[model samples]
Target: MQFAGWLGMFAASTAVLAGCNGTDAADQSVAASQLAADECPSEGVALQVLGSGGPIAEAARAGTSYLLWIDGEPRLLIDAGAGSFLRFAEAGGNLATLDAILLTHLHADHAGDLAGILNSGGFEGRTDPLPVIGPDAAPRFPGTSEFLERLMSKEGGAFAYNGGYLDGTENKPLLRARDITTADGSGEASVLDISDDFSVTAHPVNHGVVPALGYVIEAGGKSVVITGDQSAASTLFAERLAATRPAILFAHHVINGEQGQPRGLHRTPSEIGELAGVMEPDQLVLTHNMNRSLSRIDDSRAAIGESYSGNISVAADLDCYPF
Candidate 1:
């Protein structure tokens, strides 16, 4: 059954890539090449790249966001960066069915679309409060409660009138923000069990000037890890994630060189390779790409391949992986 399902998905993907919608053939080719079988599971897990770009907008890439559909429903959304809202709608995902959101950090590139999603839900007549999970914010930014208060506060907030929907007279979706606590000196890393079949754990990583994080998601017996933004050598995070034997690792390529220099926040291509090697995942996916990294994809892959023998791929916008 799994093999048959795999064949069907492959065929469907091929059809989508064959100029079905009058899209540029080159664009379809790029999307098809990035799609991977390992990331897609036949049972019930589906991974969709809503926006695979970086903080800066690119004609080809849309900020940073990933959607995981379980049993054909939006189970989890990881990061809602700059343009992810449009991508989410274009993909036909029902925002009303979203179970929760996991944010890796407070970077504009990663969490910039939160307000947009809230506004969209209001327009769609959704009244239930949506749960948002992220690292603790008081010392950093603002915890979930304060984040919403500032956004929808009636007094000195951005969307003062937006609070009317949450009063129960009309259908207003609530934003339930939950803080994830990290270990002292280790940064806050905690596990969020959304359901019996789905659970996610976060680990703190280095993304200079901000409290950054990475997540390891376990669903349908498959484990997937996403490194939000970190310097290459995160011994603590790597050691914890290594135990999961993730099927796929969505690692960000931000930093380029050593740890403590000016670029102390992001990971270099070689560092990403080392992380993949330690985790030993079935596949390694590099994303959050910038112009410099995108130009050296081959070199990045080669660097990571030296330490990791698993499948390596560079993700693009709207790329789908079935798991």
Candidate 2:
């Protein structure tokens, strides 16, 4: 089925894009129609871009987040970045339908909306414990479980009033935060089975000093990989995922190239192309768009085209890509 209020969604999205991207009403309307046409199908595995931008507070985009739809139900949440709570609502999402929530890292842009989503879900009558998975602790970063405790713990959490999410009290469902230890110097990825139909494997990716993971999600006989803020300094992520030949590869496109941006944080456009060329995914979607990268879209596409010949798409908020 199509989304419940797709027309309203298009109007809101068009207004936001027109204001942020400096596009005219006609251009925004056409873009909105294109996104609407790619809406998730009712009986297949598809991906919905909840928040396609990076950490920046862009008017046209939210922070990085994605919803995996299976049989028309939102089954897996990849991240709940800033503004994703609203995007989820606009996309007609239901918390009761999610199987688990996966956080690639604890970055504010990637996990900022976690509590808000849980608070919203509390009123949705969901009783089963929801799983929140993320990377293990590093020198500066806390583990996934500790992060949740600090945010929702009854004792001294920032949002102690919402402690029911952690302790299963206050008439709210339980929230279980689990840490997945990615590969260290070794190249092996850590695997976790969420259900008979959904499984994920995490590989260590270089994101400055932050503990980050690149996830390869296996669902419904299809494989999809998301590289969260990875840099070209490390090749472990690409090496491990190339064999999977994922149906869709969501590569972060935060910077145009390695000139002004930090090389340890995000990959350059050429690096993204190299990764996509090695993996040979059926579709290569560039997400985590930032102002710098968005401004030079054609140049970035040309650079990526040097190494990859597959279809490359720049994702916008609420865009859907079925696999």
Candidate 3:
């Protein structure tokens, strides 16, 4: 999608921008100083869902992507999915002000627009280096370093023209990639201590060949767990959920039960409810909805409500929440 289209969409939606107060001069100054000092703030975090739809495309929602704004200025982008490049602009998130880009997994529905984001940053004349973090590379999909190498390696790469920036010769934005590794080597995952004010941890989950992950983000005295895409019955997921009590749980409602036939990977509404019940988050925000889940929105909410007493909200594209 074009940047113009995104700006148009943002201009058309008064509701999305209704609650956002433009950052005060002091806040902007703090954000700029933090960027220069490589420091992260410890309060006032906000989360926005850029693409809440699942693998299967939906007109109402895009794929799975989230924008987390910290201290009212610095933005952390998670999972740049197919339409997320446009959605980010539509959300009025400044790509130039982005602090970092974190990917849960290499699934196309999750990290498809990573290159597009880099390209957009270059186009916007951003000269600062941006950090890209994700799991180690596998045969199926490239890891963080390899992914960037393939883009700007200077040897038969897509964005080879920008290699001068990688060498610090030209005044182009540098793209840095960081691969997260697990401790036990059971699978690749890691807990990223972003700063004193915030942290993020990734746990391997069941998603067929995709090497899926779920993230736990902590900031501003609140925490949020985002389950990218996983099998509801996976015990690893339960173990991870048991470790922390998040303020909000953004779970996928894929609904994978059909006449007793087992679905490959992904959760059913009932399974999500059980997990939410175990985690006991303050609120449950269902996201990454497909037709199966969207058609049964009411049923999904009711099923989760049976197991969890907290507030339940079905996420939509560009949904905003204060954390």
Evaluate residue 202 in candidate 3 and report its C-alpha lDDT on the 0 to 100 scale: 76
* Candidate closest to the true structure, highest TM-score: 2
Instruction: Report the Cα lDDT for residue 175, model 1.
Output: 65
**Which 10-residue window in model 1 sums to the lowest lDDT?**
33-42
Q: Give the TM-score of each candidate.
A: 0.82, 0.90, 0.79
Tens digits of per-residue lDDT, candidate 2, 77-196, equal 988999888888877787898888889888988999988988898888888888888888878789899999999889999999988888787778788778877544233577876767
Candidate 3 C-alpha lDDT tens digits along 112-174: 787776666666767777777776666676776787787777886787886754654466667
Give candidate 3's TM-score.
0.79
Clashes of each: 12, 0, 0
Candidate 1 lDDT score at position 253: 70
| Candidate 2 colliding pairs | none
Taken over the whole model, the C-alpha lDDT of each candidate is: 0.71, 0.81, 0.69
Model 3: which residue pairs collide? Answer: none
Error of 2 at 82 (Å): 0.4
Collision count of model 2 = 0
Please tell me which predicted candidate would have the highest lDDT against the true structure: 2
- lDDT tens readout by residue for model 1, 160-186: 778753353357766667776643217
